[model samples]
Target: MRQGRRTGTTALLVGPAAAFFLLLLVLPLAVVVIYSFGERGAAGGYSPAFTFDNYLSLATRGQAFLNTLLLAPLGTLLCALVAFPLAYFLAVKTSPRWRTMLLVLIIVPFWASQLLRIYAWLLILGNRGIPSLLDLLGMDGVRLINTRFAVLLGMVYGYLPLMVFPIYVSLEKLDKRLLEASADLGAGAWGTFRQVTLPMSIAGVATGSLLVFILLMGEFIIPALLGGGKVFFIGNALVDLFLQSRNWPFGAAIAVSMVAIMLATIALYMRFMLGRSGLRQQALV
Candidate 1:
């Protein structure tokens, strides 16, 4: 009887949360799916008319899709490139005393809002900031703000901490003896890193890359602020559709498509990671 009561209480506690999620998340997603197939009303909201025109309209935002697809991956790669070495140094080389300090420093910027940090970048990269310094060096006025480079730089800066912590944890928990064993077997430093260190840290790299890439796909602010409304992305398209154009049906279609693409990317990343895991096990054997 007591066990029955306990189970009943647990179910009561979980029921509200499950229902809340179903109502708040699943129900809205279902609406989106339904609306994606339905036609826009003459007055501009969802209508009873069923059609695939919304899906077909996806091609209209091809440039945004292409830009997001290209830049998100490139930005993720750049973040990884910059983050890995710092993570490696902090995790493998730094003393315990300094490791915490260094890691804390990496994350300290996060204490401030990301929007604020990006705004700060505006000051540094603006006409009066870096351009003035360049003028002093006899360099011509360089347009830094409102460019793809600025967007990429902001992405790398914003996401660096997210990348570093994961890789650092993975490296810190790594078996140093394995690395020493590889070196003892006549492998060079790079060989040992490639064979031992890099392989083990694959999980972290995959995780961090996925996290950054998914967020980047949905990102609009940095590009909007730094690219000066010129750099278009799927996220920007969604924002424009909802806010400026107020085309919810088409926006929902685009959003659904973005979700589909994200799922596909995650699925592929998981498969690749699983294959790598199998290879690592085989190599160990």
Candidate 2:
């Protein structure tokens, strides 16, 4: 009787959360999946008939998919490269007094809306901005805005904070004695950092990379504003499909595909990270 009561209490605690998950996440996803296999109406919105045409027609948006696949990883990598040194400086180099102030500086940009930040980039990269300055230096017709480079620049700028904080936390949690031990054992600065510091802080790097990659994969706003509708991504394609074209079935199909791709990508990434982590553990042992 007591065990039965305990079971009931546990169920009572879990029930609301389970219901919320089912009602919100699971229900909407189910609806989208069902709609993905359906047909579009004559005017707009979804129709009841089931068909494979929507998924089959996904090839039409191949360019957008290609662009997303290419840029997202590239941007993530760039963000990681830029963030690592900054994160290292914060976590290792700076005194505790200065570190807090510098971190605040990094975070201050996020207090403003992302749209406003990108708009600022837009002005800086526009014709009469950087290009005009370049023209004075005899590099006339230099264009920075509305290109793949502009999109990449915005991506790195916007996502830098996301990349930094995770890495900083990871490095902060590192045991300092390990470095001291390495030095006492006659390991030089480079060797100490390579074997001790890097391995200890890799979790941060992995976390930051994954966070940046996932966000970049679904990024629409930066590309839209910076690319000027020229450098398209899957997010842009979905926006156009659902909102502008009102092709719900097709949009749902693309959304489903994007989710699948992201899942597979993340799984592979995790596996790789785990394998590397295992190797690092064995090496340390």
Candidate 3:
């Protein structure tokens, strides 16, 4: 009787959330799947007629796909490259007192709206900012804004905190004695890092990379603002489809395809990380 009561209580606690998830997430997704098969109406909304044209039309946004595919990974990679070192330093090298302050500093910009922060970058990278300084040094009209470099820079800056926090957590929780043991076995700093540190931090790296990659895939505001409407992504395409063109069915199709691609990429990444982890375990043993 006591066990039955306990089980009932547990179910009661979880029941609302489960119901909420089913209603919000699962039901909506089922609707999208159903809609993806349906036809676009003459006025542009879902219709009952099933067709594959929507999916086939995915090929039409090839450039947007190509751009998103290229940039998202590249942006994630760049963020990881920059964030790893900062995280490593904060986790392993920095004194605890300074580390807290520095970590706070890293996240300070996030207290402001992201739009505001990106706008700040616009000022910094604009012709009046770095380019003007360059002009003083005899270089003229160094155009930094509205370029791919600007987009990349904005992406790296905006996402650095997200990347750093995960890595910091992983590295902070790391077993320091392992590094000592490696040194005891005559492993140099770089060798120890390659063998002990990097391998151990794979979870954090994977987490940060996946987080950034998925977000970057859906990113549009950064490209629009930083790239000055020149650089386009699938995110931009989707925005146009829904907001500008009001093509609800086509927009739904694009969204579904984007979700599918993100899932596939994340699955591949997880598999690769797991394989690497297995190899690392073997090497350590």
Off by more than 4 A, model 2: 1-5, 183-189, 276-285
User: What digit string (tens of lDDT, one per residue) describes model 2 on residues 51-112?
Assistant: 99999999999988988999999999999999989998998889999999999999999999
**For each candidate, what TM-score against the reference?**
0.92, 0.91, 0.89
Worst 10 residues of 2 by lDDT: 276-285
Give per-model CA RMSD.
3.2, 3.2, 3.5
Arranged by TM-score with the best first, the candidates are 1, 2, 3
**TM-score of candidate 3 to 2 decimals:** 0.89
Report residue 194 deviation for candidate 3 (angstroms).
1.2
Candidate 3 lDDT by residue in tens digits, 211-257: 88878999988887887877788889988987877776777888898
RMSD of 3: 3.5
**lDDT values of the candidates?**
0.86, 0.90, 0.86
* Candidates sorted by lDDT, best first: 2, 3, 1
Give the best candidate by lDDT: 2
